[model samples]
Target: MLFVGGITLLKNFERLMEAFARVHERQAIPLVVVGFNRWRFENDLAFAKSHRASAHILFPSFVADEAMPQVYRMASCLFFPSIYEGFGIPVPEAFATGCPVVTTNRGCTSEVAGGAAHLVDPFDVEDMAQGLELVLSDQAYCQELIARGRARPPTSASTAAPVNPWIYSSKYFTKLPNRRGPRASLAAPWGISREPLRQCQTYQGTNYMLPPGGVMVDSPDRGRYI
Candidate 1:
């Protein structure tokens, strides 16, 4: 089975659908897409219909985090041809779960793949299709990617503590005063609300604080806070 994880506009679901259609025409491989967004969901549904791939593609939106490892393990390869990403958490997540990846040749996704993925041009539907076909048909190549992925460093915050101890340390997350009262002044130097900081504190049940005036963005893919 072919798998595409984390659907979003920037995730380039359109190109993936088109490519999957091409591959399906020749092989009839099933494509499972996991994730959800109202606008993206509707648009992707239309795109799949237009490509004549709606019947072969499965959209099981919003898979729980606890079950994601099983999804990855079941997948022959995780197609993540995102046009943009802060860190592309799914690449590492897939790696950790023994799933080979097919991701964009550029940007953070490639970096996250770290030579373990089948790199494809996200803008080129044919390239994406060929990459998918190669991974699905070539068992040796697929095993090579799985071996490389298994050798990659741990990506989750909890497992990365040995590599970066500060990630789990108390100093990494600064406690900010409440924003609704006089204590809000204490957070004035950072010029950000307590809610954002609180989000960092609780992200993945780990503590992470940004520097003064630093911006904290929660990646839409699996709440990968950075």
Candidate 2:
């Protein structure tokens, strides 16, 4: 079974669907797409129907928190290739549920997977398909992933929440006495090398980072950290 969360473009739904079209030809692996985003789901379903792959795709809308484990239990693997993410909670969650994951190296998925899951390119359909095939074809590889996943360390309490602007800002920045101003520290994620960050002010009392290459921040509500 292949499990994906949403139909959003960034989640790489279309590409996963394409890969499944190829995967189904090799073996009829069932796809379970869990989400409640109406417009996006409709769009992705339309694409699947057009490709004649809808028969193999199952849409289960708005799965509750308690039932999520059972959902994970039903799957042989979790397939997530998000182009970006605040952090991939599902990666660790899947690990906890004893489900091996095939995810992208994009965003924080790799960080969260910690080498437990198969990492693939989110952009290329064939690469994604190959990864799927590899994990499914090799019991040794799948067991390695599951064993490593079980042994993988839990993410930090801060990481329990999605990696957000607040992840970089709230934890790293300190406010001066009498609200003199907000100052961001050079601190990076734990065990990471710290770099120098110039002083900057907060937006609406919320600290954010504007890095050298580009200004980026994660919205806790939106789930994208950019």
Candidate 3:
């Protein structure tokens, strides 16, 4: 039995149902959709009625995490072509369970898969078909990935950098302001640019001189140039 699991969005659920219909034509594989919504299946009544193998489509609302290993063992591959994601966790989990993964190459999915899974453009149906084909038809490639996946060690946490809790705390996370506005003027004393002015005064009644440190600091308090 082939298993499809994820948040049951209407569009994705419909595609999964249709794809199963098409694939069942070539091979009589039963599809058990775990975590799918019953409302979605009911709403697509007409489409479901016209499906080639409606009986083969099983909708199980929720499956526990502990049972997922058994689910992966029961399937040939996991077909997950989500439209978008920030960081896909399911791909890694599927790979770790010794299941071949075929998913979209959107967002950080490519980085996560790391050539361990078959990738395809989410928007291209042909690409999705090709991805499915590569996994299904190419036995040697599929076996190679399964081996790599089994041997692949778990990844390290991205937020493992050493942070100074005393210097910067969680409170600073919410208080950051957007820097799109004009930059504030520097608060240091203005230095003489053209020539070194030990003590020179301009019409504005300010002094421009090279400081002891030879560093120039722009200042708004002193008006005249010296």
Candidate 4:
């Protein structure tokens, strides 16, 4: 199994570790946790040790972007049960790399999964353990998820164009700072200039925004662009 996120409260790493311990009790599965934050590393490590799961969990700390695909391909499934996210990039990344996903039933994760993943309640440890077991034991179901994931990206990409103008407008208005503000130093790196940015029709009740030149896409409250 694999998990990708920093050791942050919002990422819900502790709950995942507890759930993994339950799964490990039944089967000696090695879980690769592929990100870390300094603030929580010691506490997370202590929790793992307390659960007797330290030996089974690997904290890789950081993995290079170019090597992420290989990491995803090696895992049986990607576990991403974040409490909240602006958008969940790892879901689609796992999808594109043909890794089955077991993510949260709520928030942007369920939307990104597009019914192609094994959804579990993030707060329910038993449910999460069951999700992990099902994905690991059911070969047919795993393949089905893989097939659906492979089919998801293209359809999502084709529908993302309508949101580009929204992205441009939102980023210009919200992310860019005035010429003399404290964040003025960020302008050059982000390619911001004095030129007037175009405004696009706002898609009401949506939180979608695409970075300049980013290719990943999604729908309103149902998909994401990364």
TM-score of each: 0.69, 0.69, 0.58, 0.68
lDDT of 2 by residue, 5-50 (tens): 6668778888888888888899788888876564577777778778
Q: Count clashing residue pairs in model 4.
A: 2
Q: Please state the error at residue 126 of candidate 3 in Å.
A: 2.9
Q: lDDT of candidate 4? A: 0.70
Clashes of each: 0, 1, 11, 2
Better of 2 and 4 by TM-score: 2
lDDT per residue for candidate 3 within 1-226, as digits (tens), equals: 3545443452365665665566667767777666544456555645665677788776665787667777877777877776665455566666767888887777666777777888877666666766676777789988987877666544421111111112123332332344332323222233322222321212122333334345443432443333
Ranking by lDDT: 4, 2, 1, 3
State the RMSD for candidate 1. 9.6
Measured by lDDT, the strongest candidate is 4
Q: Which stretches of candidate 1 lie over 4 Å from their true place?
A: 1-6, 155-226
lDDT of 4 at 55: 86
For all candidates in order, the CA lDDT equals: 0.69, 0.69, 0.57, 0.70
lDDT at residue 83 of model 1 (Cα atoms): 89
Residue pairs in candidate 2 whose N, alpha carbon or C atoms collide under 3 angstroms? 218-225
RMSD per candidate (Å) reads 9.6, 9.6, 18.3, 11.2
Q: Give the TM-score of candidate 1.
A: 0.69
